[model samples]
Target chain A: MGMKLDEALVRARRALDKPAEFGPDLNVSEFAVVTGGNELALSRGRDRLSLVGVDLSDENRAGSYYQVDESVVGISAKMPGLTVLPFEHAIEEGIIENYVWELVPPDLDKYTALNAIYGRRGYVVVAERKRKIREPVQACLFMSSPGGIQVPHNVIIAEEGSELSVYTGCTIMPEVVGLHVGVTEIYVKHGAKVNFVMIHAWNEDAHVRPRTAVLVEEGGTYVEHYINMAPVASLQARPRVTLAGREAKAHLSSVIVAKGRSLMDFGGLIRLEGEETRGEIVSRVIAKDFARTTSRLRLEANGIGCRGHTECNGLMLSKRAQILTIPELLSSVSDAELTHEAAVGKLKEEEIYYLTARGIKRKEAISMLVRGFMNVRIEGLPSKLRRQIDLAIAMAAAGL
Target chain B: MRMTALYVRNLFVRSSGEKMILKNVSLELYSGERVLLLGPNGSGKSSLIQTIMGNPKYEVVSGEIYLNSERITDLPTEDRVSRGLGVIFQMSPVIRGISLRDLLVKVSKRSGVSLEDVRAVADELNATHLLDRSLNQGFSGGEMKKAELLLLFAQNPKIALIDEIDSGVDVDSLNSVGKVFQRLFSDENRTLLIVTHTGHIARYVGVNTAYVMINGRIVCKGDPKRILETIFKEGFNKCLECVGVGDEAR
Candidate 1:
């Protein structure tokens, strides 16, 4: 089922040329270079790499939407595994396997690798990864080259009754033309469960565009969470999932932190097509230091006894920081219940005063409040992941 | 006679380049003495208490304060509290997520005091019922004052600076608070510096001497019953005659 890997490389390079026109030197990491080929291999000292790309359609067919930049390095599945496919791969393979594709920015692009380029820019896996992977597969895409881009295509399939978790994050090295645009897709089988988390933090002057889509089978459950921590830039992405099977459940949560001239256009979409399906969408954003953010949520319920809920909360730290939230719900079945809510405001003075009265200084008071706000989500994550996330948040807050 | 348990000399408090709120206000506390500070609104009684507690918001222009022969004017709030000093703020300190019993336990442990003593004080102050509740969270004004009493009982500091325990308190709360103070100030080594405007607290909680403050200066000092009666009958006008306005509070 593995076609000529070189053709995919050629097609991806053409897409890379679009962003390359502004400045060829920007192309630090070349996507066409093959670092290592196997089920998975760690590459070091790469300028450009593309992680994954989806056909942007169900039938793995290829067209203009199939093109992506040099960040995602193209490679063949040397090992016989999941025979995975990008959204486009699904179209071409004629396998209606559940997956999603997105055109996210460079910062989000780094999310598909390990430590955002501690070694190489990104990674790719081609294995028959069916529902057996209990641990959430985490891929961190890190870019070391300045003004370079990475496109990663990630695919996960839960075989019948198999459960899995997937976490992906993107970080950029300093002065690097940090641009990462990525797409991811998750497929849950009958009675299977999948939890997906995406943490996005980009350097200043970086752009992020990420899209994700998931499909849940009969009695399957899916939980998706996206965290955006970017610096003085823009993040445009939409993660959507469909509960298409009977008794399927879907929960989506998102957090976005924008500071210093940063602009974020973030949102999520959920569809409940199965009977007795349940769906929840929660989003939070904090904008500070002359930053602007917009959050939107859309949910659809079509089956009897289906339920959907959406909430968007925004906290503006500085006067110049701006936020806009939109929460929308759609229900076709009368038996389904759908609700939506949205709010935007600054830190509460009473909460700050409360901490200060505890003998905490004013600055320390503010920091503790801010830490408390972020800790809500931090506490929910696993211990090791929470530590790394906290370090990154602290660095970003300090304007590093 | 016990030496001065607390002594403040030439104390001046200022904020934002302004004149001292407490202009050269000075006073002395002796062991086993409960001194009540009386003054009109903004007359510097609370300011005096805050300065002695080392609240960072108020800057002392020139002043020196001592507790049991050791100067504490330059100490931080926690350090002052560490040095056998306990204060109950005028406004109830609102706390959250910390249960009353847990906070009492933490304060006792940090103070290097016995938990059994804290428990006994909690029982005496009727705070045992509140042990399950969060510290000062959702507490009424009266309840919050009682919480302060509970803390003071558990702390058992050598010097206690109590601010407005009678203000905004019901009769029952006042009685309980007074009893708590009696238990706390039972030892001869303990000194009480209480700030209040009402004479009723003096009636309920006996004090050795009363200081009448007018516009930041301690204008008069006499027996608690006499000064409180004078202030009630004549207001601050009588205080002006006792100390010439020409001189600062000291």
Candidate 2:
């Protein structure tokens, strides 16, 4: 093992010793990793990976993968496949070896603990300069083994003037109990644009913690859309993005549904650190069936001519369900502008009555409103991916 | 056999915990009959129609409402709608995130009407451009009235309760709306109870009977032309005098 790996492992152990506090109510002390899907291991052990058996097909099957338990069973890539490789390979090839810990260090307890004991932690995708990859790169991470802990690290880099889009879905089998801690880092170079879409569909007992960070250089653009449409035991994630170059821009949005007694704490932070930088964060949350969700958004403008805005909206579906929204904006320079808006409430009775008066049942009317509330249009996404998102949203609303 | 299209007897209603808004209101509309209800603001004109449509906010202290000779006093709003009761609200609430097209689709499906018919209705109302827009959000007064009319057209109810549909509409839209109302009233099988303060709509569509409402009670009922002329020339006080309740009418 390299000296850096040895040092990272030691740091990881020390960080795990002092676990970071997620929230006052969530408990992650007794969680442990389990192993069960040997069939997945045998099938994935082959050299070539096919995503056919997992129900992912053409058009919807852009750069797909099936990660069961601690192993990646099937994996494939299309147009951008030539530049995609395991993170470990990237490290060995010295592509990002020195900058591995720069974005997300082992100082954070979750990252430390994940780096210490994770079984598989390597996937990186790169888009070369000035190349526009029209197709989305799709990936799926599934947890089938009960009580298993799955930790994966992903890195994506967009070179100068390049454009790329990625779609990632993380799910679990029925009735499975597991914890997923994923660390993702993205880098957008000068004049480049990157759009990232992540969909999380977990079982009722699955716990999820995702750590993500993005850095956009001068004149770069970054757009991210995160959606969680399934019921989970508990989920807590706070992603951050920094516009470190002049004239860079970023937009982050999330749509979440909390149901079945699940507890979710989701947040996003953006730091405008360069001149003429801009950022915005928008989150929409729906809570039902005794679920509790807290959404937090913060934007800080520290450089001259920087502008940022944050918006958070939530809907409560039941008396037992709860939703909390907190939006904050901070400006350190006189020329910087920051603003925020937040609202949490139940569907309007008048709106519901309007539909009911048209002969729609109250329940169906509420569902339609909820679906519409959760439908936050994202610009620049491919039509195919937008359709997939629409389907997922419909399924989620029907379940509610 | 003849059947009563709508019948309300001794209808008393209160809003939330407030005092009574509608007191001992009685109304009867025979099948194929058209009636005009005139009242000043806050005279329970909206409450009466909304109560008939089963708005739960208005507590029906003691009342009975029947549609097609079937009692619906205890039915829900949706059930009442299923029984062919439709209303055009005076001030329609904006429903965020739901497009007019989606709402019309749902309404058409539930009413057993085709999407093409709904579109045609919208086209007639000059609301085809609003199909993809959010329901009632940021719409002008004339546009909102047109949208409500389009929904009512799609509902194709046996009896339609139109509350001040002529208010706040432009002259051109008023003419168009009047033309539509004329066509709707041309169907001898359809019934209408239109609530208007200005009685401007009476000029466009024929009204068979007119009722003057004051202080939550109907003070007078007579020929639409005579009563409208009395209310227009000498105001509602004259109509109150005609009912021998001039002192009590507000």
DockQ of each: 0.10, 0.63
**Candidate 2 wrong stretches, greater than 4 Å:** A1-13, A24-55, A80-82, A97-99, A116-122, A275-277, B1-3, B179-185, B244-250
Cα lDDT, model 2, residue A222: 94
Candidate 1 Cα RMSD after full superposition onto the native fold (Å): 10.3
lDDT digits (tens) for residues B2-42 of candidate 2: 57899999898999969999989988898888899998888
True contacts kept of each: 0.02, 0.76
TM-score of each: 0.57, 0.89
Model 1 scores a TM of: 0.57
Give the root-mean-square deviation of each candidate in angstroms. Answer: 10.3, 4.1
Instruction: State the local distance difference test value for candidate 2.
Output: 0.79
Number of residue pairs clashing in candidate 1, backbone atoms closer than 3 angstroms, sequence gap of 3 or more or interchain: 61
lDDT of 2 by residue, A1-400 (tens): 3666667777777676555455333244555655555545434422211211123453654465556666665566676422666666677787876556557666576544665456354467788889887777765666767777877777888999988777777777768788888878899999999888888888788888887889999999999888888788888887889999999999998989998888888989999999999998989999888999988788888879999988899988889998988787888899998988888888888888878888889989888899888877677777766776777677777778
